[model samples]
Target: MSAWIRMIADEDADDTLQEVLNLARTPHGTVDNVMRVHSLRPSTMKGHVILYRAALHDDANTIPMWLQETISAYVSILNDCDYSLANHWKNAAHLIGDEDRAARIGRALHDRDPAAVFEGAELALMRYAEKLTVNPGQMEESDVTALREAGLDDGQILEANQIVGYFNYVNRLLNGLGVSTAGDVVGYYAKAEG
Candidate 1:
């Protein structure tokens, strides 16, 4: 089992909760329903909210948000976490500026690749993230070299690994804890699809 966020009213939340949820609202129009559903999990929610923001907003990574989202979505898919799979796939579609790549990655992660992924960092990120998620210990220098050849740097490799690793950890936690996504956030994202 894992720890899960509990729902709360605005006044009861700590400063970090208020700030993080408020910030999420500004961009996404409201704190994500997944986040809201787990509001009382102050520490977990705070850490997750911050991690997601970093995943998308990091300045050091040469990769674009879409590419990062692709990595997120792909790993989420492998881990079978419904939590971020769909939302991140669509988000990646928006970030990457190409519907096809997003759709392709989504499908590829689901083992339903229509043909082959075209454009962007599909092959490299997928191979690397998959290797990391499926077998972190098994990763070799060749894997790192392949990712570098595909345009990732040392930091990017680390970031990708960390992102994939943490999400998997969180996904398992959520599953074991019986945590569910916040409906409002899901609906918001569903509607935001434009």
Candidate 2:
């Protein structure tokens, strides 16, 4: 599906926008549809890329990258975001080193019961992601307490919140804008399988 807004083509991009596009390219040598959709507002796209990298990739955070991807995948599933779900589930499977296990986790998360696939702190974190995604207004201190009890300190909980919030925002943005998954993103998962 085409986006509601026009994406700036590479050849037509201005110098600043070209730099942003260059930075937005995935390792597979293509920019994501999410980034391209944001080309209408280059600065927002730049800020989004920066925030996404920091939230998910900053080495200072103790949260494992695989877990982050799992949280993102869970959130996307809960939100019914096909684009993000496919992208993150692929990443999660790659990180966990077993596509079957990741697929099982995805199925469990889709059923709103990841207990079948996770345990202890991981389960706690998944529950937190669910509450934060489904009913942010109902969140209580007890929610934070659950994470703490599961061995996540304040910093790690904060990181988890940021990741969940970011994915929710992006999912809504893409879904609201009718942003279809890019061809390369589909190819990303296909390449992973082979």
Candidate 3:
């Protein structure tokens, strides 16, 4: 819940906000608390969803979905946003399908040691994400050069950058608004339907 305004869920959303609520629904059917916070401005919420889908879900993206989730979780960790961290960690764990591997990734991100969990292109990407999150101004052409050397073309590198930037923006938004992670997003939808 945010300290600024009351959380607006489906039940409480008015006509104008309902569209945003619908667009914000997760696969399980409930709207995310992050989206509820954005419900303060329906149009912004709509545009946010569109941008999110395009940045993270566009079919043409060469970056693997699991890698995108990993980038998001890593950025969330750097931003110290437990809300986004928990949600993205769940997505990453599910996509990765190995608890042990996921735990290693978590530990690596928490310890700020990407080498412990990744290598080759993955390691390069993680390092780039850390740099982008911690020192965006210091980012140089050399960083992009390294990713290219790791086999990512310009488009993939751009998508990776966008994903990192998106999560940073979202983590700050949720953290600034005092948003809490709603446990089991799917469970929220189930409970609401029941």
- By lDDT, the best candidate is 2
lDDT of 3 by residue, 66-107 (tens): 888889889999999888787777778788879999889889
List, residue by residue over 1-194, the lDDT tens digit for candidate 1: 12354466567768877876675562546565555655766666677777765765678666666667777777778788777675777667776666776566567668834236743345777777787887888989998888788776888877777777767776676566555654444522355434
Looking at model 3, the pairs that clash are none
Model 3 ranges off by over 4 Å: 1-3, 183-194
Q: What are the lDDT scores of the predictions, listed in order?
A: 0.67, 0.87, 0.83
Report lDDT (Cα) of residue 149, candidate 2.
Answer: 96
Predict model 1's lDDT versus the native: 0.67
Candidate 2, residue 31: how far the Cα is off, in Å: 1.0
TM-score of each: 0.75, 0.92, 0.91
Give each prediction's root-mean-square deviation over alpha carbons.
4.1, 2.3, 2.5
TM-score of candidate 2 relative to the true fold: 0.92
